[model samples]
Target chain A: MQLTGGQMVCESLIREGVEVIFGIPGGAILPLYQTLPEYPKLRHILTRHEQGASHAADGYARATGRPGVAFATSGPGATNLVTGITTAFMDSVPMVIVTGQVGRSAIGSDAFQETDITGITLPITKHNYLVMTAEEIPAVINEAFHIASTGRPGPVLVDIPKDVFEEMGEFEYPEKMDLPGYKPTVHGHPNQIRKAAKLIEESERPVILAGHGVIISKAYDELMELAEKAQIPVVTTFLGIGSFPDDHFLSVGMPGMHGAAYASLAIDQADLLIALGMRFDDRITGDTSKFAVNSKKIHIDIDPSEIGKNIPVDVPIVGDLKLVLKVLNERVKPTTRVDWVQHVEDLKRDHPLMHERDTDELLPQHIIQQLSELTDGRAIIVTGVGQHQMWAAQHYTFKEQCSLISSGGAGTMGFEVPAAMGAQVGRPDKVVWSIAGDGGFQMTMSELATLAENKIPVKFAIMNNGFLGMVRQWQQIFYEKSYVATGYSRNPDFVKLADAFGIYGARVTEKSQVKSAILKAMEHDGPALIDFVVEQEENVYPMIPSATSVASMIEEPKPEEIRQ
Target chain B: MTTTESPKHTITALVEDKPGVLNRVSSMFRRRGYNIASLAVGHSEIANLSRMTFVVEGDESTVEQVTKNLHKLVDVIKVSDVSIQNCVSRELALVRVRANVQTRSEIMQIVDIFRANIVDVAPDSLMIEVTGDEDKVDSLQNLLRSFGVLEVMRTGTIAMDRGLGDEQTDKDNSSSTHRMESGL
Candidate 1:
């Protein structure tokens, strides 16, 4: 049957089981928008900006483990998706970005709204394509989804020329992809698995350093079983927060820069480090030479390149983490490291994560703790990057898998709101919260309209500190407190801004108002915003100075020295 | 493993003949802070597959990392470090140099010493084509420079292992199984 390129895109998405998409309409993408009414089953949520659409799709992907779909127009519309696309790319979130381009003839002629999106997004995407004909739409869409969701999932872009969207052609979606060079290894080598098991059995102080791969691979049960069977303590990376139950006896907590001091000390002291599905990012490994200096590392990652790219591994197993853990769980013998567990407990007690509450002013840490307590550590907490992000990671205890969704690799500011909306849309049953600092919230607060329009009940907690808190902290600690562009002299009344968007809003200035305001926001049927005016100059502690070894951590100052 | 000096490495990769594969490969090198000395790419024996050869200047670990990272790309089929292999390598260079009435004969004598061909000749300049190992091409380019070489374009090294008879053995050795077996 003959179909237009726009129809082919819709049909292919339907065939791929995509039920929802986030996009904004514009001149170049008018054809797709015109055909949208024909397919009522595929729901399109209109976002105020392309960046919001892209981030919402990313949040949806992270929540559902499916490739989220997003659409944008040519040139500026497509360029706006760059930040979101890079965020998804850095975090390995599966996303398919469909962008409209100028007509085939006008591509490089600099026609109206014409941009080389494929060229610009080349490095940021797992793969991308430029379609010149309508007949190629189905195949391109199929390939785009497949490539985006396959091994080491990431964002893929498919740019279609406007003429192709209007052209008529035969449409057929291939049942099987003919990508011979794109095979991903899913099974670990038996020898490597056996060697890793041997290492697990022999080691006395073994620690499982879990990363985003654990959640992506859905290896939570296997990870838990391995930890239980080997009696090994688990320390999660920033992105790996919810992979292991935080309340579990074997779970130590997050480890890295701004990680729990005890967790960092445990990683430093471990004799054997079993790294699962996580790249040793620089933030996690302060100084590569001194990171886990005493440990014999066993790295298991689906991407073979990540195994030893950062840190040399003693036993490198290249395959899917879930499959490898399943096999290793069966072969590995049950053992106990009583002394190691006790040592971790002792360290945790000595260097606990706590802030002084001697002042009457509201503290961000206390508010986050209240939220965690109110939600029983079960809500899907999405946070933008900054001081509040680190505070949330430190205070909000995540007990469920895939619960904490944040921009870990990219550390993108303004990610929380749209991402929280996507998460709420993806998982309507769960409680979703977007925690943001003052600076990051202002970056993409325009998405508050998208939430109100869609009636997506994503509660937002703005830790308003009146400064770019994280950078301010760095300047205060590293530099001579030259506050440059960090401070915002005049800030908008957040409550009034939220009310302007037709959503419930409240401002909590005193500590007494924090709990009631959060409760009120949680009870609201639709989107709500709570502005918690937190202490302005707070810093994340246990920071390993840049280019320094993890062993040399800057501990929190004496409580008497802290200014209220 | 403890080498202090950076060494030149010859890397060969098999990739799908798809759009942006070149950009993907080159951008990775640039983004990862690796230097590409020279690069050559052409269609391979197989259908829809292209072969890419590039020379990189890095230590042993960096070269190892480069090969592993190239393999991570979905478009890349296989990656091999041919620097340590018993292989026959060749590069093609086209050098355009000044060939005035006085220097024409002298240039011809030097070209003859290197067994190169004069592909194009103008009144003032001659373009010579030469194919050999990197050293041979480098020496020829150096000698041509004395004659005021106008421009030089060299195809980076394309290498293949010495006859393993089946020839496919090299491909098999470059497979993931071989990589796993070799503990790389």
Candidate 2:
């Protein structure tokens, strides 16, 4: 039963019920790979790049609600995971990153391939540890899992020295972690809860600003009940896309700098603001002093420090959103504020979320809508950040939180396809869609091989605008429409590219053929890419530019008043 | 005035041995818009295992809920209202006071009055070490400060039951008994 540290790590991972580990090998982690083959149940996925592996792990974490494990060796291998780790950290995704450290004696001396990964990742991870012995490896892994998945869940790292993995020790996993100084309080003061409930009951124009915490805490049903009881309008953060169904009467879409005008206006006029599972990031709350000035705010989040960090909270509730929302729903009286609801509806009708409709051309919004309708809100929709992603957010009516996953924090361009493949593996029964622009798709197009190899049948809808659409839009607005390096001349034929991977592919240039093309892609059963040649000059409008007050967004330009 | 009784209260805490646990604990109450008149924590029967004692100055119902929530954390092992239980509390402080020729004899007399020990004697300073409850430490520190106290270091207050029974002892004895019975 005695095993080396390398063997012990694989054994511990096996014990944790980890079926697959995504990693890239190098000199520092040779010992780990040497022992990995012995564990038949644990599969090791050899990623082409450490970034892909980290993102794949992140995808798995987002899909499964469990910490996805990824490993890499020191130096370049570890550095490659930095962008992915930061992506996971910024979005509060739970992950366990095990990096192969240089030998203990060589550390700090800057020996070959040695890097201070723990020091480098200090600010990004929830907590990290350097294992000195094989015996400590199991405990550190256990602690990493505990910290990564617990309150305000975030990524944790364990840097394992090469020598420690080669050493021998008793391999016993600790049942409980003894982190004395790291207790997080997860319940609200009853008096404060009561006070918050009373304020909700009293306010006429109340709104619920739901964020990613709602999804993380699985509080959608409770949030719905609270909204119904208070009859308050609900707007969401980009990450909280599907928290409340877009079809719901009270569901105004996301409210922020790039959010729907009606949602932003509602937030601007609210008398009582109940912010749940939201950090009130700068994107959401512009000029914090001016945001929600007329409202008495009740801020509820899992982390205590975030309660008043950005905006002051009249009543701060610290606990899991599900529990807090359930309790709040129970205490709050059922009352309908019809007048306030109608006022929001008025805004919605006055300046609707508009997309330029081109009858003969395949548009991004049209493609996204057909995709949403085809999936019937059951698919996992991931997006590469750009006009395509925003179009999906604006048009697709997602039914649940986490249903629409994207890199909201880092907004990494190449994350959609591989992340979608990772998500599909987690949700095998459901369809997974990766909606990326022509510019974003090319960033991680190599992941097409991953899909083909793994037999993960993801639907990739590439809005082929033949340019970096968002950047192009900015250039059009800010700079004279000179079109610098934004446009692409000889774009690769996406159908031929998908065919190169030995999968189904199609190109839809006409609007009439868009639905049939998507349906055909969905029917293929293997990985399929539908490159819809959308209008190159199309821009995502109703966009409240950064730092611009949400109240005064330039709604769609009049039909004839268009400058072009 | 509403003729209703308020809830009970208990101060439950988990503390580290870093500097200023007392000031941090007490000041937390002040900062969070609460008031704490009494507080305590010290090394348990187990080394580096510290026990905290603090009274929750609040309504009874609110105090009960707070204690329950606090005990839910892994760091917080036990929660008991020392106010209800007969307990002993103690604090240790080292006071370094100026000991010039004129003040040395007077300071020595004052130290003796408080049953303090001169742990260190520099050319012009005597370090007087004292241990007791909060009031005793405060009174002693006041007396020494008048003698031109140079510096002060106090171990935060720690408390335990006056009787033989304690959480640390109970767990230790149970484990030992189990080991003997199992013969492992």
Q: Which candidate has the highest TM-score of all?
A: 1
A214-238: candidate 2 lDDT, tens digit per residue: 8888888998899887899999899
Model 1 C-alpha lDDT per residue in residues B73-170, reported as the tens digit of each score: 77899887776654556889999999999999999998898889999999999999998778788988998888898999887888765544334543
> Which segments of model 1 are wrong by more than 4 Å?
B1-6, B96-110, B118-127, B144-150, B165-184
The interface root-mean-square deviations, each candidate in sequence, come to: 1.5, 8.4
Query: TM-score of each model's B chain?
Result: 0.83, 0.62
Q: Which residue pairs in candidate 1 have backbone atoms (N, alpha carbon, C) closer than 3 angstroms, thus clashing?
A: none
Top DockQ model: 1
**Candidate 2 chain A weakest lDDT stretch, 10 residues:** A354-363
Error of 1 at A316 (Å): 1.0
DockQ of 2: 0.07
Put down candidate 2 lDDT per residue, B1-184, tens digits, no spaces.
Answer: 1011313233546544544344434433554455454555656665655667665557654455445434433334556654333344466889888889888888889888877788998989999899765667888899777778889887755655445344444455444434333331
User: What are the clashing pairs of model 2?
Assistant: B7-B59, B7-B60, B7-B61, B8-B59, B8-B60, B8-B61, B40-B53, B41-B157
Tens-digit lDDT track of model 1 for A116-155: 9999998899888999899988888998898899789999
- Ten contiguous residues with the weakest lDDT in model 1 chain B: B175-184
